[model samples]
Target: MRFSGESGNVTSGIPFGLASALSQAGSVLVAAPVMLDGADLISATFVRSLAGSLSLLLTVVLSTERKAQIRSMPMPIARQVFSSAVIGTGLGMTLQLYAPSGGPVGVVSALTATTPLVILPLIWFFGKAHPPGLAWVGAICAVAGVALIVNAG
Candidate 1:
């Protein structure tokens, strides 16, 4: 949340962004072989279940307060869990099913970067966040850049 000093500003999110990117890259790298070997669905489900279990265990072990917080906000927690189950696990498995058969990891990963574009419309329609014009423009540019990279490869 608050990343910086008492002012709660002037903090760079680059490290967090890099960590997320690296994590996703590692997941894709690990899953690619399984997918190419034609065990994608099983591997994806196993990985998701394992990760979710470990995450829950870690949270319970490390932070009782966090667990209490989650329990206190049941609706938000439920929404997050549902979204993760659907968008993260379901979509990931679906992607793995098609990715290896259709193209290389680079193309699939590049295409995956288009999530922001998908989220933009969803946020506008379902959520209360009305992103600015520049946000939409940036999302478009990001998708275009990924498209160019995939096509170039």
Candidate 2:
């Protein structure tokens, strides 16, 4: 698969798509246990942050170029990392706290599928990139599918 425009080219989607799906599955696995155990959101977030920090540390230690790469990364990329940490880790986990204990994990996971809907507009307005009409259609369809799953759950 390929997508081309001002953002350049995406020659393949399979690897990233699979990685995203697996990451979501792992999140649900971790979250369901914590919710079932009645763990506080703060503690859950702390544990997650700690784990992420350790993983970062391990990667930096193992990769000689990692520290330099981070140091030289552009401000926009750094800002994105910060935003993702705040939104994906902090806000997202906080929302999961409201999930009913032992309720279907699918509901919470499905909610995450709305990210494209949120991202599409952000890219258009903030990033000033115009996605093709098909991209909008796909994003809308994704949100609709997620909504259906949420309603069913």
Candidate 3:
């Protein structure tokens, strides 16, 4: 998730931060029309899935380096991706599609956003990788960010 400047210095923050922003935006974009106009959730999800699949296909087809890397991906990594697709994209989105735009749903939605924060400690406590302190700080901040968005009004 690191990016490089013209000087090739790594600029971190692409993994969680970028993906979180995009996920929030994508949900709003998809949810708005569905909530307002009574659009079909299955159709919306299917279209989003098709577009995402096409984008990935294009990335793999267009970039030899990316294709090579994906081709060489280990079984464990592939399994992780498969599970994520099933749980995160499939089941999660199906549930989210039924959620209202506001009320208690927002709180529940925000709490789910804290999964990484919760996972970080479990991973550390289990003797896995000793993640950087800043990573924990970032996860904490992300969890706290829910306060900023939730409105009692």
Candidate 4:
């Protein structure tokens, strides 16, 4: 594999991918029980939303460059931010909470990690564009791998 300066070697990709996957899995596993143990899904969502909002606010407040851009494009920028909040924050969190209610944690997590598979159809449905052949093969492999991994436990 050609080693770009940014990615010293092909081997670097392996560790980076594994680390990211592990970290995401760890974060989900840690959060699932906390959400599940709460009095209701709304309570869990409230805590997560409050924490996420505070963290986002802190990041925005601490960034001078971002602050300038935010101040310059108030209306258009605010609309984009609102859109992101609706889809990524609101809809995404709602889906996450429902996943655990439908199945075992391991299975839910495995399915969640197979997000790449779902992207193919979502791209077609939402973007009206189809993925290439390699994407199909990769999605199939991902689904099979997730099935094996989750069922192995």
TM-score of each: 0.71, 0.69, 0.65, 0.56
lDDT of 4: 0.72
How much does candidate 2 score in TM-score? 0.69
Instruction: Please give the lDDT score at residue 11 for candidate 2.
Output: 45
Top candidate on lDDT is 2
Of candidate 3, the 10-residue stretch with the lowest lDDT total is: 1-10
Which residue pairs collide, candidate 4?
A: none
Task: Please write out the lDDT profile of model 4 over residues 46-102, one tens digit for every residue.
Answer: 666676687568867997976986789879669977897878767776677667766
In candidate 2, what are the lDDT values of residues 45-82, reduced to their tens digit? Answer: 77766666676688688877778888899999999998
TM-score of 3: 0.65
List the lowest-lDDT window of 10 residues for candidate 1.
1-10
Model 3, position 126, has a per-residue lDDT of 66
lDDT of 3 by residue, 1-153 (tens): 321112333354356457656766566555765655777777766666666667668757987977888899999889988997877766666556556554355665675566667777776686455767787778878876876766543
Q: How many steric clashes between backbone atoms does each model show?
A: 0, 0, 0, 0
Clashing pairs in 3: none
Candidate 1 at 98: error in angstroms?
3.8
What local lDDT does model 4 show for residue 71?
83
Q: Write model 1 residue lDDT over 45-128, tens digit each, in one string.
A: 677557756755784778787687667877877998779778776776566546756788877777776775787887778765
Q: How many backbone clashes does candidate 2 have?
A: 0
